[model samples]
Target: MQRSKLVSQILEKKNYLCVGLDTDTEKLPAHLKNKPDGIFEFNKRIIDATLEHCVSYKINTAFYESMGTKGWEIMQETFNYIPDSHFKIADAKRGDIGNTSHQYAIAFYETLKADAVTVAPYMGEDSIKPFLSYKDKWAIVLGLTSNAGSKDFQQLILSDTGKPLYETVLETVAKWGNIDNTMFVTGATKADFFEDIRSVVPEHFLLVPGVGAQGGSLSEVSKKGANKDIGLLINASRAIIYASGGEDFDLAASEAAKEICNEMKGYIV
Candidate 1:
């Protein structure tokens, strides 16, 4: 989907919520465990239930990849099942040498047809450029993440520039692609850094994880991270999808998602 369409969806729905489909069979309700295609079934219900309240869905490939071929098939089916109006994301942090990155790009962009894919930028421009070559697709680069380990490298000050590595990453990468095509992954846990981050890439969208289950504050993120276009896709996974362990999992999931969406609406102009 084009960036304009995504912005319109956010405005029209009065939401910037991205539901993470990190479906785990072991954690699924016991009732669904015995059912055939439980993974897809759970995802279908989650999609159907929360579609109205969310603007995007992020599928973390690891959950599906662990299940092997069956998981891969369900992942494709779930991707296809999502409505075109809602943005679909492949939360596969893929980045490698240029040639390998090319195949990875084709796998997610062409074969699976995801609107966006999470990419690790450790390999530099060659690894990232291949994904950017595709039209209307996005490479959500890992910037300052929410993980505790981010302190090891991303927060380190650069030798010459003296700015943090993550800050440099945002400044340097912003020149490679315009805001419409390239986005940065700034974890919600790093809410305090949003001010500095905005100073660099003020217009580009940010895919923010670490909310909900991770205990990141929504209001803090909205205040620090939002741009004039409401440029933030706040994602919630275990908090919403696994809201309940009973048969009413879908309903509970929808309720959890709606609550976040409502909170998000307050952030929107």
Candidate 2:
């Protein structure tokens, strides 16, 4: 999606929520658990329920990949099911040697038809460049993640720059691709760092996960992370989709999303 289009959606919707379809077999409602297409059916209902309340959907590849061949089909089907009006993200977190990365890019952007794919930048620019080669596609490189493990490397101080490693990453990675083709994945749990992150890459978009179930503060993230375009995509997975486990699951999910969307209205403008 073009940056203008994404920004327009945010402005029009007055929210930046990105519903994550991290659909797990263990979490499937009892009625759908034994069905052949249980996972996809659950996903369809979730999408149908929450489509009006979000601007994007993130399909975490791990859940589907764990299911083997059948999972890939479901992932593709889910991607195809999302309306073109909303941005589609493949939260795969893939990066490697240039050629291998190129194939991964093709797998998501061309085959699966995703608007963006999350990537690991620890390997350097070559690992990310392949994803940027596609028009209107995004390489959402990891900056400062939300997990407890992020402190292991991302927060380490650099000897020469007198800055955290992720700060250097934000400075350096921002140069590889212009704002149009690049974005950063800064976990919403790391809300305190948003002001500084904005200082490094003020014009680029940010794919912010770790809200809701992960307990990240949406108000703080929105207050500091938003640029003139409101460059943020706040993701919520289990908190919304699994809002209920019974037959009312779809309505419950819709209500959960509506609550978040309403909360977001107070932050955007």
Candidate 3:
């Protein structure tokens, strides 16, 4: 999807929620465990339940890939199942040498047909360039991530630039790709850094995780990170998908999503 259509969806729905489908077969409801296609069944219900409240769906590929061929098949099925109106993301933090990254790009963008894929920028521009070559697709580069390990590198102050490494990544990458086909992953846990980040790439979209289950603040993210276009796709996974483990799981999930969407309504405007 183009940036215009993505921004349009956010405005039209009064939401910028991205529901993460990190569905684990082991954690599925008791009734679904014995079903023939339980993974897809669970995802279908969650998607149906929350579609009205979200603009994007992020599938963490590891959960599906662990199940082997069956998992891969269902992953594609789930991707194909999402409505064209919603942005589809493969939350696969993949980055490698130039040739390998090209194949990885083809796998997610061409074969699986995801609108965006999360990529680590550790390998620098060569690792990310192939993904950006595709039209209307996005390379969501890892920037200021939320995990504890981020402190090791991303937060370290650079002597030359007099800024943290993550800020340099954002500023340097802005020159590599425009807002239309490039975005950065700015974790909600790093909400305090949003002001500095905005000064670097004011127009780029940010795929923010760490809310809900991760205890990141929604209000803070909005106050500090949101651009004039509301350039943030805040994600909620376990808190919504696993809202309840009973037959009413879908209803609970819907309620969780609606609650977040309602909260987002105030921020979008």
Q: For candidate 2, write residues 65-104 as lDDT tens digits.
A: 9999999999999999999999999999999999999999
RMSD, model 2, all Cα superposed?
Answer: 0.7
Q: What C-alpha lDDT, on a 0 to 100 scale, does residue 169 get in candidate 2?
A: 88
Better model by lDDT: candidate 1 vs candidate 3: 3
Residue pairs clashing in model 1 are none
User: lDDT for each of the candidates?
Assistant: 0.93, 0.93, 0.94
lDDT accuracy of residue 174 in candidate 1: 83
lDDT of 3 by residue, 39-59 (tens): 899999999999999999999
Please report, as a residue range, the 10-residue window in candidate 3 with the lowest summed lDDT: 168-177
Name the runs in model 2 displaced over 4 angstroms. Answer: none
Measured on C-alpha atoms, candidate 2 has an lDDT of: 0.93
* Candidate 1, residue 131: lDDT: 86
